[model samples]
Target: MFESAGDVIKPKGDVNAPSGLQSVLDVEEAAEPVLPHFFPDEQNDSIPRLSRDTFLDILDGKYNEHYDNKLIIDCRFEYEYDGGHVDGAINYNDKELLASHLFNSPLEGRTLLLFHCEYSVHRAPLMARHIRAQDRTVNAECYPRLNYPEVYILEGGYSGFFAEHRQRCYPQAYVEMDAAEHVRTYLRFW
Candidate 1:
């Protein structure tokens, strides 16, 4: 169906649907960017996944020993983020904004990225991959080199992390995207 608009999110037969951002002035359906569990090795993915405990380590300054500079990215919608998230995470749901943030930051190794959505299943992984891919495109001359080489994703995502490490979260409340209150209170406006 996305044949004419560059097919950036081409699906291979029926097993998967590869999605990404390709802004061309609203000419077609804007599919959500979701990275499937079985992302092919061909896609530009060299990012690492971290467990909840390890994520806590990073937050507590145990992982980097000094905590230098780390960026926790919560790629959830505004309402879900306002509901509750990692204390310092910035709610940036757009891929382009994420790429801009990563690309502009100097390659100092101090700014580590911890990207996650409600499940780390689709949204978060896709955004991380997008930034890495953009890095590759611009860094082609400097092959095998990336602006922010080592970015990370939280395994089990915030849902699992919040349950085990409630103290670490700010406000410590979890809100699903399709919560009844949200649907009744806000979705009608959209």
Candidate 2:
């Protein structure tokens, strides 16, 4: 059995015992914590979060003078991304590929990196944790003279952003779907 405390899912049984139970665990023991999807009960101070309006402002060049570089990564599935996504945002469905892109890409000059998914709850946080864990290695190799960019997750994900700035979205066909049907279809994973 499993019990959910905020975003962390805890096993009801002895998870540490040497048995067949290891594979079932979703999180591994590590110094840096890995967060689950955001629930009303979960409170984490490590992962920085950005509001939808703030993100929109950034996109509108509100912070252009302050931030020299910026990147918005959308971590949804290919189809969901194909359906609709933020302008200029890159789609990276696989975590491994995202990691590789971060490692090989030029990010030292960047000042901000924003990550988001359908709900800005689970996948985004998970990816942020992964990047934080690998920060040291990336800095050593990728940014020898520069500093790491400030990373943040969209507080409500694409859903929240879309709710507020529907005009900014692309692929009208996907965004024009029936609200109820769209929710049922896209949010089925939740």
Candidate 3:
């Protein structure tokens, strides 16, 4: 009697439904809830801070097979750096000079970057933060944003490192000089 009009379609039983032909609403309802993929919203005060021992390990190649690309920036006066500094550290007293150097030669594939002054309290963290800011701004302009290497500030600065690893220090000038005099001369501001 129902076939007199033509043909009538009937809903299939759940057992007879096609394997991959489920309705969109049913699929969505059955799917697991999705979670966001992003960093937590914790307030980052500044660049990451590395302890003196950790910094020394990086310098000594404990973390990587090779330590050639690692850079240690000494953000102190040129005279102070010349007097004595870390073995392979580069002097960048002025922010402008540091920024210019970073712009000219990007640190894309570097393994690690360490920044320190007399005390890691101020200059090192400040410069590290500046470098991070530059990376964010400059990478934004590129077609595919560049991934900057991680930057760190030495926790206690050069003084702390020197006290612990005097053997790794360079030039013998500062190492041989009077410790008290050195503190008064270079670390007075710190």
For each candidate, give its TM-score against the true structure.
Answer: 0.68, 0.64, 0.63
Per-residue C-alpha lDDT of model 2 across residues 1-190, encoded as one tens digit per residue: 3354643665556776776333434432232212222333476646678877778888898777766677788888666677888888888866778778777775555467789888877888888777766665654433322234467788988888887786787764234223564677657655
How much is the lDDT of residue 76 in candidate 1?
80
* Candidate No. with top TM-score: 1
Report residue 33 deviation for candidate 2 (angstroms).
Answer: 21
lDDT (Cα atoms) of all candidates against the true structure: 0.72, 0.68, 0.65
Give the winner by lDDT. 1
- RMSD (Å) per prediction: 15.9, 16.1, 12.7
Model 1: per-residue Cα lDDT at residue 122: 79
Winner on lDDT (2 vs 3):
2
Q: Look at candidate 3 and give me any clashing residue pairs.
A: none
Q: Please provide, for model 3 over 62-126, each residue's C-alpha lDDT reduced to its tens digit, 9 standing for 90 to 100.
A: 76654236778998766668877989999887777787777787654534667888877667767
Residues 1-190, model 1: lDDT tens digits? 4656556665457654434533344333322222212333544655667877677767777756533567889988778888898888889888997787667765464456779999887789888889778977986655555555557788878898888887777778998878887886446534
Model 1, runs deviating above 4 Å: 1-46, 65-68, 105-109, 184-190
Name every residue pair that clashes in candidate 2. Answer: none
